[model samples]
Target chain A: MGAIYKRELSGYFNSAIGYVVLAVYYFFSGLFFYLYCFYRDSASLGYVFANMFYIVMFIIPVLTMKTFSEERRQKTDQALLTSPVSLTEIVLGKFLGAFTIYALCCAIFLVYGVVISFFAQPQWSVVLCTLLGMLLLGMAIIAMNIFISSLTESMVVAAVVGMAAGLVIDTMSSFSKLVPIPWVQFVLEKIDFLNYYTNFTYGILSIVDVIFFLSVTGLFLFFTVRVLERRRWS
Target chain B: MIEVKNLTKRYGKITALDNISFTVDTGEVLGFLGPNGAGKSTTMNIITGYISSTSGTVTVDGSEILEEPKKTKQKIGYLPEIPPLYIDMTVRKYLEFMFDLKRVKLPKKEHLDEVMRLVGLEQHGARLIKNLSKGYRQRVGFAQALLGNPPVIILDEPTVGLDPKQIIEIRKLIKSLGKKHTVIFSSHVLSEISAACDRIIIIADGKIIADAKTDELSGVLTDKRQLLLTAEGSAADIQNELKKIPDVQKVKKTGESDGAAQFAIEYKPGADIRRDVFSAMTRLQCPILEMRSGSESLEELYLRLTGSVKGGEA
Candidate 1:
């Protein structure tokens, strides 16, 4: 598992995709920081972190589009799958590989938080909470994309589907608003990732919210392992 | 040793492997001979724990692949049809990754060096796999499989895309590996199987049609023995003289060159009329210039067995 993790992480940096994803992610992140903080004279960094979710929606797909699809296409999965490693280990290794890259981009967001502190002394607690929220949200989304990546051989298909799935999850809050039934709307809003993420921007750290994010991440990783196991039988 | 029992695999409505069973003793080189879409790869995949069978079990050294996959897989190294190489990495990096993936606990440097040397990739370890030629990439894939020195090695079409020289070299490497490990390789080419394997399992249409020693398979497919004799005589006179030999069922004139007639003398089952034919040819004034027997080569038998749709099972 450690070997697969290292190989997968190195694979991203060895190609142009890693650099391109980071550059595109930070460009928008910097742009959003400028628009929400400097140009508008806002002291709080919540808007910058909040808007960053939109950028994450796009970058997560690129981060995960080739996780398993490329291996299958190149026939390299045979080496990994036939090895002594269990299916759970293979799934976890790949999930962590993509998460590390996502985390690097998030780490850059922390630098932005520091730069903002030098200017306006934004609330440290709020910034930390939002950073935690961003990671949880990103972890769950990355897990979902890895599962999508495992289902196809073409990277394009994985990317497109991942992007679509991300968009659907991100917009679930508004989609729930359109529902007429109060109880149904309540359930959807509770499950909507944006609803859970919005709380951290205001320094809201409910145990339920953390559990929700963790559960989503765990559920998707488990599903990914099941899908891979099912492939062996198929 | 590897043991497979009644392994059957199905894809929706079609059965890919139909109740197939075979075993490979330790340190034996076994060949899976079959045409395309004949379930050769499917069986290899099952044995290596890369996939599961629909209704059967594969055991490696008494560990069931499904129940104890990690233990069974640790005992096997599989090279699928296409060399599964991460093209971006150098050969050395790729091998090191494989060692780690296979959980090799010993010192990595020495084992990797030995594997690289064995596969003739010692000097090219620094080059990225994408930059290497196909033959070199294949060698790297072969080198990856040998990393942990597993007890069982499964290669699916190991020489499919190599040049003639590389093919021969890979065959020799496989033969050498057989000295210490149980090897099972699949190929549709009869000559490759016959040359490299001690036992051949001939499969057609998802079923094992024949399984025996290389020479014995030819004997099983052939019911009658034949001799090709070139005699310096008229075609009709040579045919009549050859017909006079007892147990000679049919004598046909196949060709005539320079006034010498080539006759195919087919004998009844379990008959050796070579000396009698020679004496009769001497008496008939038809000097026998050339004599060749055992007309049924493994190649012909393979064609005969696989060509027929109703090719019987062994």
Candidate 2:
């Protein structure tokens, strides 16, 4: 697992993918950070994170597109699958490598929080909770996208499918608002990931929201492992 | 040692392998021979635990592969039809990664040096695998398979794309490895198996059509030999004279040539009619000028079995 993790991390830097993702992500994120907080004179970091979550609809595809699709397309999966390592190690290694880059990007959000502290008193605990929420959100997206990547051999298809899936997950309830019953609406609202993050911006670390994010992430990663294993039997 | 029992693999309606079973004893190099798309690769993939068989099982050294995949896989090294390589990595780094993947117990520093030297990749170790030539990439794949010194090595078409020099180099390497390991490798080339393996398994249409020791395969499949004769007589006289010998099945007279009649004599199954013909010709005083027997070659036998062979150059 360590060997695969190191190789995947190095692969990210060598292909310039890690840098490209960070640059594109930060450019848009910094733009929103400046627009909502600095120029507008607002104390809400929630705006920056909310917009960043949407921004992942675009850039996360770029980061995770080649994770497993390129390996299959280039026929490198043969080397990986024939090795003695268990399937779990291969999936976990890739997940951590991708998540590491994501955590690095999310850490940069700390600069926004620190810069805000110079002005009116900022809530450090809320910023910490929001960062944790952001990490969980990114984990869930990475898990979901890795599964999409494993399904196709074309990088373009993987990237496009990832973006589409992210769009549906993020905007799913906006369309599902057509449901009539209040109970149905309540259940559908739970599916809206951004709706859960509303608690973190106000300094309340909602347990249900944390559990929801972690469960979604776990479910997708579990499916990704199954998808790879299914190929062997097929 | 390996034993495959009633192993079958089906991709939907197409059965890639149809209940094929065979066993290789310890220290035996079993040659897997088949025409294109003959399920040889599928069988190897199942045996190596790269894929699951739809039905039946593979046992290596008394351990069932599916039940104890990690332990069974630990003892096997597999190279698929295409050499599996990480083109982005340097040869040295790839080998190091494979060492970890195979869970090699030896220290990396020691095993890396030995494997690099074994596959003759020391000079080219620093180069990215994508930049290396096809033949070198193949060697690195082979080196990774040999990293842990597994008891069983299954190589698919190892020499397919190599130049003549590289082909001889790899065949020699496989031969040397066979001295210690139970090697089950596949090829469409008849001469390669005839030269390298203790036994050969011939597969066709997803079935074990022929399986025998290398010499025995040739002996069973192509035992017939034709004898050519020239004599100072009419064609009918030579034909009549040749048929009187025991075990001589057919005698056909072509035409008179160069003041002698030419006749072709064929022997019955497992028969040696040369001595009988020699004595009969000497007694008749017909003055035999020449005699030739048909040869049973691996090429001829392969052609006879597969039927699509065109002079065997490919």
Candidate 3:
């Protein structure tokens, strides 16, 4: 697992995808930071994070799309599957590899909060909670995309399907608004990831929301391992 | 040692492998000979635990592959037909990654250098694998399979697209590795298997048609006799005389040069007509220049057993 983790991490930087993802993420994120904080004279970092979450919906797939598809396309999976490493290790190593890059990009956004604090008295605890929420959101989305990559050999298919899935998850809050039923609306609110994310944006660190994100991430990672193991039988 | 028993695999309606079984002892090289789509790759995939068999078992070193995959996989090194290389990585880095993948207990600092030297990749260690020639990439594949010094090596078409020189080099490498490890390699090339392997398993349509020593496969498949005769006579006269011999199946006028007619005499099963042919040539007053008895070559035997050619009375 350690060896695979190291190799996959280096693979991202060795190619152009990693840098492209970072540049796109910061470019849009810095733009939102300027518009929300400077142009509108608002000190609340939550608005910037709320808008950045939508941008991440598209960018995380770029990081995770080639995780397994490229290996399968090049036939390198032969070397990997025949090795002594277990299926769990292979899946976990890739998840962590993509997660590391996502975390690094999100960490850079900490500068936005620090810069806001110098000019106006922003809520540091609110910023911290929002950052934690952003990390969880990224984790859940990255894990799901990794699973999608395992399903196909074409990188384009993985990316497109992953973007579709991310789009549905990111916009589920709006989806709840379109449904007017009281009971269905209640369930969709529970299932809507953005509603859960909204609580952290206001400095509410609910344990239920944290477990919800972790559970979604774990479910996808587990599914990815099963998909790989099932391939041996097929 | 490796043992496969009653192995069967089916992809939907198609049965890829049909209850095939074989064993390879320690220090033995087994060649899997078959035509295209003959379940050669399927059998290898099951043994390496890369895929699962629908039923039956494969055990390596007394442990079942599915039951104890880590131990079984650690003992075997597999090179699929495609070589399974990361083209972006340098040769040295690839080997280091393999060492970790195999979970080698020894430090890989000097061991990798030694493997590089073994596969003749010492000079190309710093180069990316994609930049190297096909032959060099093949050598890198061999180098990775030889890493961790596993006790069993399974190669699938290790010399498919190589030039003659590269083919011979890879064959020699496989031959040397067979001295210590149990090796099983698959190929459709008859002469390659006949030259490199100790035992041969011939499969056609997912069934084992013949399994014997390298020298015995021809003898097992063919029982007819072919005699080449060179006699100083006219082609018509020689043909007439050869036809008189009993049990002669087909006699073809092979060549004629300098008042000599060469004919190939194929005999029916259970017929040793050499004595009759000799006496008939002597009575015709034609001097016999050369006479040699031979069986069918391995190539012909392969074609016949694979159902590409129809078999005769024997």
Candidate 4:
């Protein structure tokens, strides 16, 4: 597992893709930090992290496009799958590798928060909550991308599907008004991934929100394992 | 040791393997010979636990692959048709990753040296797999399978595209590896299997048609008890003279060269006619320059064996 993780992490930065992901992530994240602080004249970093959650819908795919898809495209999945290592380890190693890059992008958010404090008063507790929210959001996005990556050998298809899936989960809350049935709208409202982070961005740590993100991540990873396991039998 | 019993794999209606059963004793090299799309790879895949058989069981040592896939797979190393290489990775890194992949633990720094030495990749270890030649890349794949010293090594077409020199090198390597590992390599080439495998299993249309020692298989397919003799005589004289011998089913003048004649003598089924031919030539005062038996070769045997498919009874 460690070997796969190391190889995957190195693979990201071996070409321009990793640097591009980090550059674009930090560039836009810094741009938002500047806007939320200087343009809007706000000292709270929660708004910056909140907007970053939306950025994840677009950026996470870049980090995960080649996670499993490229392995299949290059025909290397035969080696990994035929190895004695269990399927769970293969899935989790890829997840953590992509998550590491996401975490690296979030690291810039910390610098953003630190830079914000230099200019005005900002609570460290809310900053911590925002950091936690950023990670949870990124984890959920990574899991979804890993699952999509497993479904095809084409990296383009994986990226497009992953981006579209994220948009689906992110925008699920907006469709609530269109639903004619009250129960349907209620379910839609509860299904929003971003809604879980609203409390954390407001410095509210709801146990339900933590469980939701973790469960979503776990569910997708479990599905990815099952998909690979099924290939051997069929 | 491996035991496969009534092993079958079906893709909806197409049966990739039809109740194929074979057993390999400890330290035996079994060659699986089959044409394309003939279930050679499918059977290897199932035996290695990379895939499951639709109905039936594969047992390695004593544990069933379906019941303990991880443990059973640890006992085998498989190299599929394509040497599953990560092109972006260096040869060293690929081997390192495979070591972890095979769940083999060694001293942090010693595993690489061991594998490189075994596969003779010590110098090319630092090169990217994409940069290495095809032969070296295949050696890297073989080195990956050699990691942890697994008892059973399954190679699918190990010398598919290699040059003659490299082919000989790989054949020698497999022959030496056969000394210790229970190796099962599949190939469409007949001479390769005869040279490297102790036992050969020929499959056609998803069934094991013949399974026996390589030499024994050759014996069963060749029919002979007659001899071709070089005699100084006219064609009519030799034919009329040889016809008088008993058990001579047919005798014809085959060809003439060097002012001597060659006669192809065929004996009756289950009859030894060499003694009669020699004695008749001696009595006729004709010198017998040479005599040789006409028999089937291994290549002909292979063609005859795999050419026939099972009847479509199902």
Q: What's candidate 3's DockQ score?
A: 0.69
Q: What is model 1's DockQ versus the real complex? A: 0.72
Q: Write the per-residue lDDT of candidate 1 for residues B68-161, one digit (tens) a residue.
A: 8888899998899988899999999999999999998779999999999999999998999999998998899899888789999999999887
Kindly report which residue pairs in candidate 4 clash with one another: none
**Tens digit of per-residue lDDT, candidate 3, span B28-132:** 999999888999999999999889999999999999999999999999999988888988888888888889889988768888888889888889889988898
Q: 2 or 3: which has the higher lDDT?
A: 3
lDDT of 4: 0.84
Against the reference, the lDDT scores of all candidates come to 0.88, 0.84, 0.88, 0.84
List of chain B TM-scores, one per candidate:
0.78, 0.76, 0.80, 0.76
Q: Considering every candidate listed, which one attains the maximal lDDT?
A: 3
C-alpha lDDT (0 to 100) for residue A213 of candidate 1: 87
The sequence of per-residue lDDT tens digits that candidate 1 reaches over residues A141-210 is 9998898998999999999998888788878888999999999999988788888899988999988889
Which of the two candidates, 3 or 4, achieves a greater TM-score against the reference? 3
Q: How close is candidate 4 to the true structure, as a TM-score?
A: 0.86
TM-score of each: 0.88, 0.85, 0.88, 0.86
Pairs in steric clash, model 1? none
Tens digits of per-residue lDDT, candidate 3, A1-234, equal: 998998888788878988999898889889988998899999987788989888889998899999899999998999999999999999999999999999888986688888987889888899889899999989999999999999999999999999998788877788888998988988888888887888888889999999999998999999999999999998
DockQ rank order: 1, 3, 4, 2
Candidates ranked by TM-score:
3, 1, 4, 2
Q: Score the docking of each candidate (DockQ).
A: 0.72, 0.47, 0.69, 0.56
